[model samples]
Target: MKSGLTVRSDNYADVLDALNKLSGTDVLVGIPAGPPREDSPLSNAEIGYLQSTGATVEIDGEIVTLPPRPFLDMGIEDSRDKTTARLKLAAQAALEGNSGMAEQHLEAAGQIARD
Candidate 1:
């Protein structure tokens, strides 16, 4: 299937969670150009996760060099939590016989699950 995907990095946690679900795909992650802000700089673990995925990373249009190996022990518990919630919503939609909504919720849950 052919499709387009776009995700904003406004919520770093969500972005990280979504990244967990990707497999064998090239991704471009862009960071705004300017003085790094304390609140916006990516954490070591996040960077490690992206490095593990081999995604192309750019900061202010400049390509970033990634380390050869990902740092150890990056957990995705937040993704599991979000996936559980979405699964529940999907179940509720199914009970209401709203197949389309159920499908949407399940799709979201799948993304969170990285399935």
Candidate 2:
């Protein structure tokens, strides 16, 4: 179990990295947390870096659900919200047989799990 504040700073990126390195496999990305904010905007380099490691990015954070399934680059309101959405999306993608995408989203979620 994770506390609300703890979840806020959940090292999602490290988690993804570990998961990738351990499994040596790719996964789909999802943003169950939502989308990235201005301060923490998703960058091509970041996305590319994750992709290079065999992962797909998705912005399924809980904040903005309008886009349904968005990419990490898409701008959103709060980092926490976006992070949550991405995490959820990543979980969904992984459960749906998209490990690459799941990993990507999980990475982003971990990134957002910061202070």
Candidate 3:
């Protein structure tokens, strides 16, 4: 797919010319997240500049630690639902080999079911 400013060339001089033209743009300048091959020197330089300016940098297949897992942000009991739904979830989890999660859901289901 043709990206915003993707420059492709077979010769080194042509590649350098493309990079020079793209240097003045607001686009992210750097080798994409993969093998640091291809016409990527300009991209590497851009990554360095971005890092120096406090921008988070991610390289090939690097898992950036985002804020947190979404589940960890919410309390378990906040998932208020009917007993049947909880039991179904528990059963599904059990069938899927998630015994711990199943037990948790089953416990919640049992509490609601008993009431």
Candidate 4:
């Protein structure tokens, strides 16, 4: 006397798709590209990195020092709460198979990073 039960359900394809879309995305934060700095040849990104970490160089035969301003970190910290909330919503939407909402939330998080 043995009994077996079978459960039937549609595979959670939407959830899978959302998970794929949200994962492995590279988020960039900080200044966008622009014309080269008048005094420095470094690109905006390079300048940002130098400012974030601090650097020194000689210009016009005079030494200049860059302090660790950490603006990138500061901006992230400023948006930390809102970004995290969006990320959480994205995750929850993905788990619930709400792919569209998940993607929207993910995009909002990206916007937070950009701004």
Looking at model 1, residue 40 earns an lDDT score of: 54
Residue 37 displacement (Å), model 3: 80
lDDT of 1 by residue, 1-115 (tens): 6567675435555434433433222222222235434775876556556777666678888998765553222233446688778767766665554556666776777565443
Cα lDDT tens digits for candidate 4, 1-115:
6568564765589778877776855555678878788877878878888889998978789999988898888888989999999999988998877878987888888799668
lDDT of each: 0.55, 0.55, 0.49, 0.82
Q: List candidate 1 segments past 4 Å from native.
A: 1-76
Question: Candidate 2's residue-wise lDDT over 1-115, tens digit each?
Answer: 7666634465566556645543664333433344554665765555444544444344655442232233343433246687779867876665555667777877777666532
Best by lDDT: 4
Clash count list over all predictions: 0, 45, 2, 0
Global Cα lDDT for candidate 3: 0.49
CA RMSD (A), model 4: 3.3
Over 4 Å off in model 2, which ranges?
A: 1-78
lDDT of 4 at 72: 84
| Model 4, CA-based lDDT | 0.82
What global local distance difference test value does model 2 have?
0.55
User: Which sections of candidate 3 miss by over 4 Å?
Assistant: 1-81
Ranked candidates, highest lDDT first: 4, 2, 1, 3
Candidate 3, 1-115: lDDT as tens digits: 7668865634555444434433332322222455443765445545444544444435576845333233311323343456569767766665555556666766676565334
- Give the winner by lDDT: 1 or 3: 1
